[model samples]
Target: MRKHFFGSAERLHLVLMLALTFSTGVVDAMGYLGLDRVFTGNMTGNVVLLGMAMAGGTSLPILRPALALAFFMLGAALAGRLLRRNGEGWSPQTSAALLAVSLGLWALTVFVLLAPVQADPTLGSTVTSALALLMGTQAATAKRLKVAEITTVVVTSTITGLASDSRLAGGKGTFWQRRALAIALIMLGALAGAAALHVHLALALALAAVIATAVTVTGHVAHRRAEAEAKTGAESPSLARD
Candidate 1:
């Protein structure tokens, strides 16, 4: 079936995206709980929270969400520019972009280490801005890559698709694995990150950085294997997935 593929490259890409999705949950928990009640991955939540704060329903600060929206827009714009220049499937340029986001998270980890001691120690606007910008870039890049259900950052539409397309609801059953995996990874990351944060604030971001870097390394390996196969007059399995 078209919905399923046997190519190793596409399967690797999907697995990498799931790792990044887990990182998204970790970073988002960091942002929402640690960084002034802002959401780094899910801009929809930021928008709604901003509106709620405006209407006096929630106590979240409006500035952080506003900054998240602005920074995410800028990040997405940058990712769009990069994608236009990339002009191919799963190019190195896209890997570079993903790496950049992870590097930003590592930078945030340093900031956390330097932070002053406090009882609650909710982070500041800078952490929120850094994470939001990268998440926006990540969301855009994932969308361009066209993974079936692995958006990596946001799960709202995935949830909607899951419910709206079920056989019980009289719609074709598709994306069951991708959608289920996406949801599960995010939840797992959130739980893991939340537990880790209680031990050390920077540990969550560090873990996220590790997962994101692993994705990049996996891409590099796949790309190298594809090149080798090409030179050997063999069909590149990785490129086939592309």
Candidate 2:
């Protein structure tokens, strides 16, 4: 039954996206707690921080958040261009983008471990911006995959859907399983991220990168197998539910 459920392409996308969402939570925690309150994944939180920073009172950073937002948009634009012509669901371009995200995270992990990132404020901000850029790429890729209710970065809408679509709201409470799992995984990721931060920021980042790599490899392999089976005129597992 588990394999039968995962045979559905949409369900596979949902699972992979939820995994990425967990990675987002880990890095977001690292960003907020370790990087001067700048959000690397959650743009909404960054916007709020930017607003407070512009108010000109506290030690809130104006440049970090601003740069993070800009780089994030830039990353999204780049991913959009790369994926503009492709249809929805996991594709070669999607794999490429996800691979880039994983590699970028690994690169950042190495830098934090080897470089004096803590000693230089500019370097820390640079790392945060890079993280935001990678997350933007990830977000755009996940969006292109068209997994409903799983954005892989933020959960505000998911939270709203959880409440608004509940039986109490007269809705059928559809997809409450994935929705609730998305919320829980992100919180658990934040907890793990914070705990890892006590050891080293690099460790948290490495964990995120590992998850990205796992998603990329597994999703790509499954997609390829589905496509091959389709070409052979066999019933593709991905379309079994369809």
Candidate 3:
């Protein structure tokens, strides 16, 4: 059990999960601050916000929220295709590819922000939609991977699990602890990103790109090790005979 818990693969997965959480926080903060309260990283929140907007209680534009939802679904579909093709072997390669695409989009966003020419609302909306789609793709990939206590993009369910499994509720699980840690990390990332955004939005995004790149490298290494081991085992005669 100790070996399983502290294994290199497990550690790599944990690091990648945390990196995804941080990415979500940074992107979500950008969306909220720059895109009129629409959460690009958390589609669940966007769905709720969309419903509220449809009810006419909020000032959010219905079309933008709807576009966000559609784009998110499209991203999820793309991730699903990757998962289906790769199976459990998807590993870091899938994440690396997705992050690479996301990095490109973020670079474009930075260019737009730095450009002397200002964009109209339509252009801004398009940017937000693309960012949201990238985030959604990530969220779906994580979901398909099904890493415990590390969904990374949204924590509402994690928070609920924490509370439901707390000591006061006669539970002995560490759900609350894990959930709290995730929330804390996200808050820290958002705070750091927000501070950076004040002076340099591109800088904050660049930080996210760095984190994603690190995760991608680590994941690929781990997956390669696993594949090597699997191949070695397959070639063992006794194992094959059995």
Name the candidate that leads on TM-score.
Answer: 2
Compared with the true structure, what per-residue lDDT tens digits does model 1 show for residues 18-129?
A: 8889988998887777666788888888999999899987566898899989999999999988887665457877887888887887888887778842243345777788
lDDT of the candidates, in the order given: 0.80, 0.90, 0.71
lDDT score, candidate 1: 0.80
- TM value for model 3: 0.84
* TM-score, per-candidate, Cα-based: 0.88, 0.93, 0.84
Model 1 residue 74 lDDT? 92
Scored against the true structure, residue 137 in model 3 reaches a CA lDDT of: 78
Task: Please give, for residues 103-191, the per-residue lDDT of candidate 2 as tens digits.
Answer: 99999999999987777899998999999999999999999998878998888999999999999999999878888999999998899
Q: Model 1 clash pairs?
A: none
User: Which of the numbered candidates is closest to the native, going by highest lDDT?
Assistant: 2
Pairs in clash, predicted candidate 3: none
Cα error, candidate 2, residue 56 (Å): 2.3
Please identify model 1 stretches exceeding 4 Å from their true place.
1-7, 117-123, 234-242
RMSD of every candidate to native, in Å, equals 4.9, 4.2, 3.4
Q: How many Å off is the CA of 13 in candidate 1? A: 1.0
lDDT of 1 at 67: 90
Worst 10 residues of 2 by lDDT: 1-10
